[model samples]
Target: MLRPIRALAAAAAALALVCACNSASGGSLPGKPGDAAATRGVSAGSIKVGGIVSMTSASGYSKKDTDLGARARYLRANAEGGINGRTIDYIGAEDDGQDPGKNLAAARKLVQQDKVFAVAPMSSVTFSGADFLEQEKVPTFGWGTLPSFCGPQYIYGFNGCLVPSPGGTLNQTWPEGIGQVLGGAKGKSVAIIANDSDAGKFGIRTFRQGFAGAGFEVAYAKASVPATAVPSDWSAYVKDILASDGGEAPDAVVSVMQTPNNIGLFTALKRAGYRGLLSDPTDYDPALLAKDTTRQALDGVHVLLQFEPFESANPRMDQFKADIKAASGGREVPLNMHMLTGYMSADLFVSIALKAGKDLTVAHFQNAARSFSDTGTLVGDRAEPKGQKESFGCGALVRLKDGAYEVSVPFKCYEPVPFK
Candidate 1:
């Protein structure tokens, strides 16, 4: 979930003194003298980086492979001559356990204790340490589902900020792709549901505008489900959603929640005899197909993705698969979206750091980030500053059918619709 804007504002004000001190240091914090590394986590022989992920969570959701994904990317980078002659000293990852307090504690350990140069592949629902990292001027990379990612100079979202504040544009992938599947959205209707969390609420708000902008009648939009627990019974949500649009099921039901919630809701909906199209941002993981029940629950459901699907024939995807296999010691594992999130997050950070030149520091890194722009990346054409506020405007939709995924709406970039 995204951090609350009010909380971020409050913390920014409270951390003003720390931020000032850190900024004045010019990216050089007190550490070993004559290190010749220019920064805290850098040394003559290596550049140290760490990660934060919700490897264990209360909702049965885990981002464990995110560490593997980052490791894979870093291994490949090191194999390819180690990011300008300095091998990456990846300190593995710290598990936040999906706790806000733990998240902050982990961040503190990485910065204050570990003295790491940067944090990459930070995949967690709660990012309470965001303010601390910002105050310390630490460069962080992760998925931009949180508002903390937006408008933060030190934090970067791999695919750009998915949750932009007022005045920023919204990615039209989900709504536009759904519209294509429904032929046209002229008189069609949609119901958007999410967990009762900041991320879910912001997702509903953004997608409400997105679908409406694409001419679909928004029948129901709510963050009613609990975020911390998966509902065993979805009767209440199903009843309201099924009858949301003028006493009938909407043409499409869009879930902005994660997989567990989706499985319960979709299964209940199917049992309740609602046959409309099912769609969501999560549930793209191939691991979910390991269970017949899980597969059946998600059958014919469209999954939205910000990056190219693993099933794609793109050369970049081929390289990604190779890297994953190499990192896993030739073990073939199910490809999931979390892996991509971690891989892409690390990839962006390394790309910018490399551009920062042989002598790397936070100052150089931020400078490189400000001017960083790359086209034809796994996600999309990426640029800094603007990306700090908005998305790269690229994504695709895939559907699960008969225990396999197929391109329902081919990968493409769409012009973003301004968020109202």
Candidate 2:
């Protein structure tokens, strides 16, 4: 599912597929009075919305917290006077089960059956609905880790697309932050690996260049591991990695993989005595620490973060914590990157919706989003139209040390390199 969606998205990107349907110029839905399509999911006092999330998957991975994160943001938005006098009629998220068919079905259900005004926080790796949602002129939001987020007029990534087309700018945060951890990338070497899937291959392409651009010698870069299941043994992979750098282990190893894969790979690397920098984009959740095996496996590994760390004293961080607590029935929960994915996805949608003003319509929303900009968010300053092309270029590194997470590099913006 992830592979096919990415292949289609890549083909779509080649043609520069940016079609803001019915936006502002000459469409009946663009603020035309009495046009039902203009107000399909709107009422005098409410604006209906829904989400698509991979809450359950065959790989035993879940993004259930993403739904909760969206709920938290929406709850606070409602409490704060409901977006220009209209409450958000959030119908909640539909579980896509991470299947391509299920993903498209969920999107159709939201648009055709539930009649949502928009799909916010669409936090799933397999976004098979991108084409359908874009065709139907529905505004969709999610993390921009996939090709679908790039060059799509109707779909937007919360932090902009980290993986962009050639000639587009690449977010150097991960590479730059990792360089700081390694006392700079000069004379250093790294091995980058990912699951053997289209999405993973795209990640390797983007990041291999990124790390090399940051001045590290790319010892080995490959997307050769299995995607559907974690390998029971990692000796073959380990053998290649240890001998990647001129027949010696590289200085650092970076994984563009999810939790279970990271745990398995990191545990194997540690056992093999390759004690250089180990890092991944996922596995920052506190819940992993509860399991001694997971915590030990991830110990000393730095996790890349696109937003402010939870330990930050920033007032906005406090607000997010409070919002999550209230959303969770006053219970404290472990925070993770998936939660931020949903929160920021919702945040971006809410920000644009607010700009859309009292005349709520898909056209109005698209127009507003085209020129939307905000400052001091958890993900950093956001400016649209530009975001559709490049990332915000801000991130941090957090290391799992001694059963706790610490900020290895403070959140900051980095200069981006061309994606070529």
Candidate 3:
């Protein structure tokens, strides 16, 4: 969950970032004049950058929050005059609650009607229209942590970072997250569950590998959960989970489910009196627990977070904290790494655009965003370069501690068993 103090602190930092907010907006960034939406070789006047996040509905709220956070940060950038004298005239939209049909339509509208220079980082690509923008070569960005989508087809993902060398997960969240609740999994039997969708399958597979790689026994791994129809019936699926005993009682259940079914999963687990570690890839927020009547049910479960808790003093996220607060009109926001990831994605692409100069094109962004260096871009999780050596590595495994999900791991650097 996003903390209020951090949001307040970030708002305070935005005031300081005003000067460095967009120093490049002085007509210098590549996607500026002749680069943006210029047709027939003519330059677009005010460089428009388009984006889509999953902000509404039960399905894609996290993705919308990603869009929301990105927009908020970009709004702060725009207020400071944008990149290179051209404010990032952003036209932000959402997939509308994980509706693939809606995202398909949103993609068409962004490219056709909006005519943006480039579309940027988004998550949970509605399995419905995963190829629209990719086939268009529109220079898109994504955080498709679910490995199946990480194939060469998507072309753009994980802030342009690929599948972290096969076994290495860009989000490597499952075992690491469950590690917080179950500690060392040497003798533990783990059960993995998720929807039959590609994302679910891939997440379970990668997590299984992470667990096995760390010497844990994967007691059960299943992703054949039936989606039933359009809007999935999660209650039925949870019943399936509860019914699947007879074998050795698992010590943990790793799930890669999306928002549409998470609440049901939690409810069923609680009712069955399963007192083991329940974990999910840090995709959606567990805040849904608070919103739903199942708040008390998710008592001891842990949620994996791919990035640093926003409040960490890594110097990388300090400025964003201030900017997001000011952009949200001082309303202490609630979120995890989505907003931070979105902010860095946009900022990193802008850096690439600046580097690409007047030669700015979709190809340039793909090339530049792919080559991010540590000192150059400090986003949520660290992807250090040769010499710099990251001060930290991803977020400390997080959990539902004292009514709020706070950092349970000690310092940084992926400690499987977080000693208090």
User: Candidates' lDDT values, in order?
Assistant: 0.87, 0.85, 0.53
TM-score of 2: 0.93
Model 2 regions lying over 4 Å from their true place: 1-37
**Candidate whose TM-score is highest:** 1
| Poorest lDDT segment (10 consecutive residues) of candidate 3 | 19-28
Q: What's the CA error at residue 340 for candidate 3, in Å?
A: 3.2
- Model 1 ranges off by over 4 Å: 1-27, 31-38
TM-scores of the models, in the order given: 0.93, 0.93, 0.74
True-vs-predicted CA distance for residue 307, candidate 3, Å: 0.7
How many collisions between residues are there in candidate 2? 0
226-273, model 1: which lDDT tens digit per residue? 988898789999999999999999999999988899999999999999
Best by lDDT: 1
Residue 114 in candidate 3 has what lDDT?
A: 70
Q: Report the CA-based lDDT of candidate 1 relative to the real structure.
A: 0.87
Give model 3's TM-score versus the native structure: 0.74
- Residue-pair clash count for candidate 1: 0
- Clashing residue pairs, backbone N/CA/C < 3 A, model 1: none
Ranking by lDDT: 1, 2, 3
